[model samples]
Target chain A: MMRITRDSLLSGNANRRSWMALVNPSASELTQAAATLDIPESFLRKRLEGEASRPLIKQERLISLQFQVPMPKKGGTGQFMLVPLSLYFVPGYFVTLSEQEIPFLSQLIDPQKPRKRWELVLRIIAEVTRNYLPTARSVAREMAVVERDLRQAQRHDVVYRGLDINDRLLTLDLGLLQLEYVVSEIGHFLPAEDAVLAEIHEDTRIELSQVRDQVDSDQATINELLESYAYVVHNNVNHLFKFMAALIILATIPLFIPGAVAMNVPLGNFPHWHYGFTVVTGGLVLVEMLTAWVFYRKGWLRLD
Target chain B: MGCQFYDTVEDVWVATERYTADGLFLLMPEQVHQCPQLEAALQRCLEQRLYCQDAEITLRLPVALLAQDAQFGTVGRMTHLTLHHTPRSLAILGEEPLIRRLQQNWLGELRHTSMGELLQRVLLSIIYSHERVARVLVERLQVLRMALKTAMGNTELRQIVALNRDLGELVIALRETGLILRNALRATPGESPVYPLLDAALREQRRIEDGVNLIHERYLAVTNAYNGIVQNNAHTVMKVMTVWLALLMMPIAFIMPWHMMTPLPLEHWHYLWFGLLAYVFGVTLLFARWARKHGFFSM
Candidate 1:
């Protein structure tokens, strides 16, 4: 893929260089492309290696930055990863090289209306920053879903719904933090002279700010969901415990009455009847049912 | 090489780990023959009969693996066999290759499933809790998008459209995250197959989708109630305006001077203007207060 870089630009000439359509280049192609543009080989190579490329030294005439972008894959959880590339721009021409095709840039720099070098670069960054909005929105959406699950988890007999919501919120929180970091980098690139790029940069900054706000809003909602779930579970457990305690108290009430009758000193002279135990047992059963009915009507024992 | 095995008798999931192994060992339980998906795969394998007559049963592996086999040449050696006794874990492992292949083949499918599941859960949660009305409103935006197509029109429709685009973009991000998760899942091994967990995950996703639909219904119901209230308010406003206009005409009638010719007082005109203005002002203040309390002005 790097094979097409310098030669492709040279053969087409500077005026006719149709660099718009060149995306999805291989690692070697990116290396070759970087070579053609007089870019440092390591700069381009580092970008493609992984999503978490640490901030490092500036290669001459080029500044490489790596940031995470959320990707949703099937049978997989969402993740933020670095997209590698080296960018080398002079007054006349500019070049970008990446192992995998970045669709956002490709859309912006179409053949019919090719963007200027600086604008292209800034727009690429701007678009990437804009991505935070959608990412935040997605997180918010997922969080909402998680929240819903937590609420209804009990209905489905799944007490683990809270865990799911917690997990989803955690993931979103991490993504939002990474998004903030990426947006802050755009601020570093804002220059006084390039007012246009500066404006674009500012717009992106606001977008990042909005994303943060959304994330904060989402965090609050998650917290509330957790609290509400906790309260419900706690209240339910408390009610059940109270009912159990009530049952014990009610059962002991009749036992106390029998003890009182049997231990009475004045009644010790009377002879025991054959049906006494049966009568006492029946009376206890009836009293227990009556007590249960009264408690149930008073809303002490909830079926749920 | 380090090899370890643990049995989870309580959960019916077995876990085994082996280092320095090049191939996977599949020990299908007798119960596997009962599963339709497994049965089909088994039947295909038996029909192909790739192995010589040494064994009575043969299992058909995926064609991509067959191509791989063709490239590498026949089953040469038993590199690894880390036995696991848990059915749940085994089932999950069985589905691993399928999940991986699906993830690779259709990123959109993966993204949609994950996103769709999430949206569903959010909606379900809001359905039970009256306190989360605002979130329910916000979440409805996604359901509306799924209901409507790409080019939904009008103000409400446009908002929904914008929301849908937002969801699509969000799904893309989630898809990226999903890829990372896939990698993590691949890296992590367990006593049980990951497939049962995945199955449950998918089920949970479906449950969430169901919840979203319910939320959508609830949202529409709430919107309908608002629309009805607006309509009733419009009717009330028309009635009030008509009454005011008729009352104003009474001043015109009074000015005709049928009874006013006897003693036309300047105080009457001042009182009339002041009263009319005060009444209008009072009505305006009341309207403003009502709108403010209901959050109409904020919108």
Candidate 2:
């Protein structure tokens, strides 16, 4: 859908200007917008088709920029979808083209809050970068939940969740890197003497830098959490193995004693006295206790 | 100058400066004042040594230098070695054994390696040594995990915590040293031959970090599992005790009332003793069956 609104209409024609926003635009809509804005239809077509074969920013009579914004995806996996946003800027007109509805663009749709074309673009960029912070925070929270689950029980489900969070955080990092590059490139195209453009450039630079730093910090945290999760799982397996080993030791003692008696060995006066049965029974019990005590003392059994 | 020269090819420290080939100079902490040129070089790279001031192996150059503490083995104390590397010469100030070992191990490479490559080697050697320590920690952790399988006690827990702490400290040291080297490399102007070596050192640093992190994760998981096992064992013990208590109470409750009676109802009866015995045996059998059925003996 294509929504074109004039800022002058809502502001009593004080400063007449128009901006176009395209949400999931078709080829025909892109062509129309391209014709109205005096831009090459191919530029809009390439962007609308989601072709990102060029650098983030391209300069000519009209300036075109392509950058990605973080979008949350639905599923058990806490993954973020990177949606590419294409912007075309001329003297007094600005246009934004996206494959899906840009959630933050609604703020600019209200014609009552009129903004200059560059100012609007800067705000859009800032909003796109800010979008990552919330996603990062949510991912961090999800990681913490997974960590808690891991502590309670080393289950595969928690591990899968942890891996999913790692994947999402990696995606966020990649997207932020591309965004930083784009923002830095935009600074080169701004007029050197324009104070407002310079100020906007500086603000965008600082904002993007902050976002990148935050993403890096989040990535480091996720990495550590994932490591801990793996460790918890390993420790649990080791515990099970240890338990089984102790069980084997316990089972071996009884088996060895009976096997020895069945071999017809004359040890302990076996088969030589009327009270042999009683003696053997008592001896078996005694030996079992001794073995258990020994194992316990050697740290092989968890009797306590 | 009255000095001893250790030859890489010969693998021996001779008490003569006759075979003075351009290579690393090993300097002791005390000998730093003896050689004015070496002393100046140490002052130049003094700031760089701050990060690794307490590290066993540190890279500061007029030539590659290592300061070995004579009291402890090379691995025992952080060898406070000052190593310097210059294009014309390599000077080291450390213990005789350490220098001799280095000479023997890198005999062929030391003879042929350029000064920059030698510097890189020194840095790489430091990183590799730390990496070895990390690997040992990892192996120890594996052993600890195996020990944990059979039982976990306070000692086992302490060992795990200790290993984790050591690995953590190693990771931090490697990172700081790596950063220092990288920054130092960047600060150097023009094209220096040490970039590749520094770059390799950086890579090794990262590898050590990764290895340490893996060990830490495994330790954490194993520790948690060990605690769970302990708890489960405790629970089982409690259940068994409860079952035993219940069983013991039944016989006591049956026998205590007989003793307090003024006259037993069938005391003169011929089968009275047999009946009481049968009754006690039947109740014991029933209670044992019930306890088993309720999962008291499941462990």
Candidate 3:
């Protein structure tokens, strides 16, 4: 539970973060219905009446930065989503506005007097994004399983899982892009001479950059998995069709022999001869066996 | 009431009282925790656990006072000592009882010669406190390992989950404290009276951090390897069932159509039903062999 001026450095283990703030139950602590800023009032509304994905907007004396941080989907979906968390430095107070309380905000330096607000902000951004690393590792494990028994991916249940992964990966990528943009802009507000703050800034930048690279790598792996998944499914269906075609052709060729025997213009008296039906039937069975053997030898009878 | 120093000449803790007037003061402000205004400002800090594990040193600048704070204590006790250094004086603020105890227990290891060396020893004591906790964590890990060997229910699994959470917190605390000590090492001047002391503090932090990390890695390995064996056994059973059903499907596919139409020789014979049954088994055997040869029906 030890926190410091550099919570970001301490957040190296994003799993055990201390989140005792637990999200205020009242929830409307930052209800700014009427502020003195020239910007749109909708921006201050709790509903966040403007663009949901806005990265940062500094207008006059108010600087508001909005970012999408990843969170697990509710209802035990086993899927992750990007939720918007907005930080506003308006007048004397630094308020963060999120639909639900993100645990990362608890690590912010005393919000009432955040003399080190920039450090906390950068750290929060870095920590929330870095949390995705563990999730990504799990996702890679899932991808490995799907890759091995890829034919099973075509099942109704597993099919949607692939889509869910794709959705989660895209959401992560979008969140990271906003973070990348926000951190670059955050550098301008840093006090020029404080070596400690500079060091923190550099660390945050490196952490975010690494996360971005990881997202890219994960994105590539998933895309490759999906492509292989498609090819396996496609090849299975095509092979099944080929095997059915061979079955049909083998079944049909023997029927022509019986048809030939019943021809009206047969001069050989095949129909009039004794035991003519048995000979024609026996010849038909022979033709069917030969055709099936040919198809099996050609490997067209196998769908596996 | 401050500035108790370890006297090099007398080889004792000296209560000279002159160092207080000399602008070097160790100020323990228990009242800061009580102040209403400061309470709101310290809310973020108060949200952390009462026990102090992560230590951070901040220098209040030329434009501001440089404050370096570290905490030292055992259970039911802790002190958040902030070393606020300014040109006028240096103040150490925290709970008074701990401050008094460090002075009372002093064995002339600290110095008034340089505040850096004193601060270094203060941090070394904090890191030293964690060694006991690490020992407890490692012992619990061993228990969890033994429990998993004869694991009959979810009891050991829950214990593992709980132990992992504890390991994670300890790791974060150790690493953060290590980084703080490392920073102290970098910032202290080699020619200064505190450099070697700072180095010793960093070394102590590293030893603890590395030791805790070894435990963490062992915990992870134990849990992961256990989970893998469980999963692999489960998968093997599932694979065997799936292969059995899949192998039956091949025979079923080829025989069902033939059974629907084909007329066997001596159709009225009493053994005719046996022939059909034998045919089904014969085809199944051949397909199973083929599957085995193709490496498709591995157990």
> By TM-score, who's the top model here?
2
* Tens digits of per-residue lDDT for model 1, A58-130: 3345544444444444453333343444454422334555545566755775656654444565566566656
Give each candidate's fraction of reference contacts reproduced. Answer: 0.00, 0.00, 0.00
- Per-candidate TM equals 0.40, 0.48, 0.43
DockQ of each: 0.01, 0.02, 0.01
* Residue lDDT tens for model 3, B1-299: 44454445665655443334233344345344433533332344334222121232332100001112232111112234444332333334455555664455422344344455456545654565455455555565556544444344555566566656566666666676666556655665567545565565665566556555655544453354344323333443444455466555544443332232223245578886787778778877886787456433443
| Docking quality band of candidate 3, CAPRI definitions | incorrect
Candidate 3: regions farther than 4 A off? A1-41, A50-54, A75-78, A107-115, A137-149, A152-164, A224-228, A264-282, B1-299
Tell me the lDDT of model 2 at A173. 67
Give per-residue CA lDDT, model 1, range B88-161, as digits (tens): 21221223443343223322222223322322222222121221222333455535433322222344454443
lDDT of 2 by residue, A1-304 (tens): 8888765222112355667888888878877877888876877776766532333434456777777888888874345778988877654566778888887787765577676555566778888888888888888778767766665442334545654565566567666666666676667665577698679878987988887788667666665665566567555444434444554455445444444544534555444455544454456678768877887787665421
| Candidate 2 chain A, poorest ten consecutive residues by summed lDDT | A7-16
Give the better candidate number (1 or 3) by TM-score: 3
Q: Encode model 3's per-residue lDDT on A125-207: one tens digit a residue.
A: 77876776666655556665556665532222233355456546655665666677688778887778868878888888888
lDDT (Cα, 0-100) at A245 in candidate 1: 50
TM-score of 2: 0.48
Best by lDDT: 2
